[model samples]
Target: MNNINTRNLDLNLLVVFVTLWETQNVTRASERLALSQSAVSHALRRLRDRLSDELFVNGRGGLLPTPRAIELIGPVREALAQLDGALKGAAPFAPQYEQRKFRIAAGDIIEFLILPRLVAQIAHEAPNVIVEVLPYPQRNDISSLLENGEIDLIIGAPGPTSASLRQTPIISVPLLTLIWQKEGLTQERLPLNLYLERPHVMIEMHQRGENVIDDALRAQGLARRSGVLVQNFMAMPVIAEQTGYICNLPAQIAHVFAQTFNLSCHTPPLDFPAPELHAYWHNRFDTDQGLAWLLQKIRQSASGP
Candidate 1:
């Protein structure tokens, strides 16, 4: 093999060479590349000069690769494949074998609903991958955090999204009221008067001094009597267990807590909208193969098996 100086190489000429070799005709290769026939011919001549070999020769079959050209074809194809993969952000992302670490910001409920399944999936599929779950920021600074590479993804309710970020909804969790079953408040359907009269535990997703349930209640000229304000959904169940306060929680978490902690799940007396759970990432990672793979696993876990 000759030691050709890569600094003097025009990579576009190799594209032309590959196209011509595949098509076996200058006109066809030019059409494929959207270049003039003259440009294709010129690139071929340059390739021949650069390698000191007549890479192609006219024959009864329109064109044929020389022995030297045939020997070059495999390596040329491999190089182009690697270049394409690199340009498309498809390289260095073999999840089945690659060791990678991804950091995430998520609410406690999102973590509870998704992490166990996600962790199991990662262990089964990408054993070397590590997932770090950071507490969700209690403010509207996710865009800056994401841009600064503080976290790889954020799983939570949608808010004011940044223009350079993308959000993919992973799951929708309906609101439910959780209470201690032993209290006998759920023997019959709880009345709205009773619900509004009881003390409650509420989740503060952003620590913004406002809860979604409270906002909805305020819209109808009503409000819950909040006895406790917690930063995470996980704490609400434990607090409710010790007190008579009802906890308004996501249905998924409420049901899990009911089964695990001997609590009761009841439909909210007020019409409450389900909160959407979305996986958000910076737009720069939109084409990232590893993020794409991890997202696929999350979606599958959300959908169950």
Candidate 2:
């Protein structure tokens, strides 16, 4: 194959090419690009002539990309993304000024525990920026979401690491025992056997059968009878209040709920380690000025001065 000429190649034509490739129809691409259908057709012809290849051919229902077109897609998209980043100036996350929406994937617990504070901070600082938080059903796929630009960030427990993802530790706090009224439980700390004997409320958000508490219990050959299963930490207080069920949750969140719902919190007797929470993102956005600024602000809020 002849190398395409670097000189006299219009960059704007590549934008049209990408739009047409994605939409696979001149009429649709024209509508999406706010250009006439004839204009889009003319641009495709020009691109074909420039590259000496019929990039797409009409198929059964839609335009199909030719082999050469398939080969060009990755490089073209990457080049355009680089060009866009350069032209857009420094910050990628300037929600105060930029009109881009940031998508975040996190568990319900993290949303309940941390988002209110983060949103308050964003409202005061980056009022124009919009945030969409989506639930991550499988924590293992979080790295894939960041790599594919599906999510800008993931806030959750310390997840398995990948080469493409970078992590920033926010805070690590011990787990506390959450119970309803302290009617029967007199001691501030209950023994491991007693804790396991009591009926407990479990929050199984990500994995169905596996839980951090279960793993800890298995280590000591002890198991707690799950009286109820709830999905979110926010529901734990309400459920425990009604059923007198005990729950183990992050100390920060447990304390917050305890104060609000007038629940009792105590140190668990088991030797369970504390959960470590971290924020992970694609390394590609590490140097982005706007994302960097937002991350710093989040860290400040999470860690305090």
Candidate 3:
């Protein structure tokens, strides 16, 4: 437990350390850092003295981080990243000229509804910015992904809840059950028993045991036999159409797919809850300018002004 408080740390030296660790060679690090090789070596020596460890050693014709260095890497990288983000926040957001990649973790339903519009906006506003949509593994890990900088933002319903996460409401849409128009499923209200009896398609984006939809159903003392269990919401409509299996999806997604596939959506017979789509990010990025700009863009796109 080194009491290495960053309050009085030299930020520039950390930058040098990162460069050396990345390049694994003092000469190459010096070239990349735009400093003399001796200066880079001196900085490494200073860092070693401060941390009381020979952080790196020569091996395989290059510098290799020692065991102690491996231990320090995570916290050091996180601190440097936070500092970098803070400094960038002080400047104006100029997306077009900035070359940066933003990775977002979102479900397929969100990608279907929000990504197209957001891409259009980015094309007009930030042509140089690259956007990558990553698959959301499970609801529980969303917070960890955002915290680790693996994903810039998460766009979906708030999973459980967390104090470390900051969620911004994008829109509230009534959940709807979708079925093929030709199935003769009338729009007239039906009883909960009828809805439960129908074959269902379930979207399970969490671990093996945790199913939010099933939990919701159990809360009301009802259970629907799932004919299909898929990881993505985008596949739900297709599966539903092929198998005549009903699915619970957000209204917007159902609307788009229904129009495309000539399906019909109806209000669920059960007292199902509406889905609240929100934009979530770790508190560490609450003040980041790039994240803020992107969040604003998403909010506006979701609102469709």
Candidate 4:
């Protein structure tokens, strides 16, 4: 990095390099930048010369970023965003009229718990604002997604692990076992033996790792039988309603299912962890007025009526 001359480099060329990396096609990148194809090509040439590397290579799909360009992308985008925000000056953010979209990454359960309230609040306060809730990427990829501006925030379990990321706990949700009430098991607590014997509907959120309650049971030399496995929490209610399968889920979600479906929530006989649902974002947005305001709204929504 020290080999490159900062003083001699054209920042606009960096913008072109970043745009080309994003679009992967010279014509499309030129269109995005409102520049001629020849001009975009010239910018790429100057960027390559300045960096002493082939920043991109033409691939079958489009243009593929070289390893060096991939390394530079996060920092380059952050720099551009910071500069753009700074140029807006000391003017306060006016979400009521500031038309913009925010992209948030979250799991199915968190989406259920938060979005309806958040959207309602935004509609009343910032009618023009759009909220894009994307499925949470794998834990390892979250920080880069936030840094590169691919996602504005992440709401789920703690996985960022990086010191640079920021997380605030929204709520601590207790774990509960959900079973169809038609089974006539009106017990307030599920006995450990019955829990082990019942067929389970597993909610597989992570690519790998034991379910939280399963991990706890395993620690106590116990295990549950999984008759069905599904990716999202939304699948549990339908299957649990249709079959005799039991599922362990967050207490709040279980309560909602209990009210709507033929299901009942029971305390797990074994000790389980009460995991805190947290809102995560890149530290870069810590002071961004819009993001800060949105974060506050998320906290309020999580607290509930």
On lDDT, the leading prediction is 4
Candidate 4 residue-wise lDDT at 90:
48
On residues 1-305, what C-alpha lDDT tens digit does candidate 1 reach at each position? 67799889999999998998899999999999999999999999998998999999999888899999999999999999998987776456777888989898887776778888999999999999999999887557778788777888988777767689899999978888877788677443456887898899876545322356777888999988988888777888888888878887777667778777667888888778777788889897776788888899889887765
Q: Note the residue pairs that clash in candidate 1.
A: none
lDDT of 3 by residue, 158-225 (tens): 55668898988886666777877887766555457767777888887563224556678898777887
Could you tell me how far off, in angstroms, the CA of residue 17 lies in candidate 1 after the best superposition? 9.6
Across 15-42, the per-residue lDDT of candidate 2 in tens digits comes to 9989988998889999999999998899
Which residue runs of candidate 2 sit more than 4 Å off their true CA positions? 1-95, 182-184, 205-210, 259-262
Error of 4 at 59 (Å): 70
Rank the models by lDDT, top first. 4, 1, 3, 2
- Evaluated at residue 12, the lDDT of candidate 3 is 79
Pairs in steric clash, model 3:
none
lDDT of 3: 0.79
lDDT for each candidate structure: 0.83, 0.78, 0.79, 0.84
Q: Which residue pairs in model 4 clash with each other? A: none
A best-first ranking of the candidates according to their TM-score comes to 1, 4, 2, 3
Give lDDT tens digits, candidate 4, residues 1-305.
64976778788998998899889999999999999999999999888887888989989999999999999999999998898888876478897887989998887877777788999999999999999988878877888999888999888875536988998888777888888887787788987788899899987757332357877888888888988989898888789888888887787778888768788889998879887778888898777899999998898888785
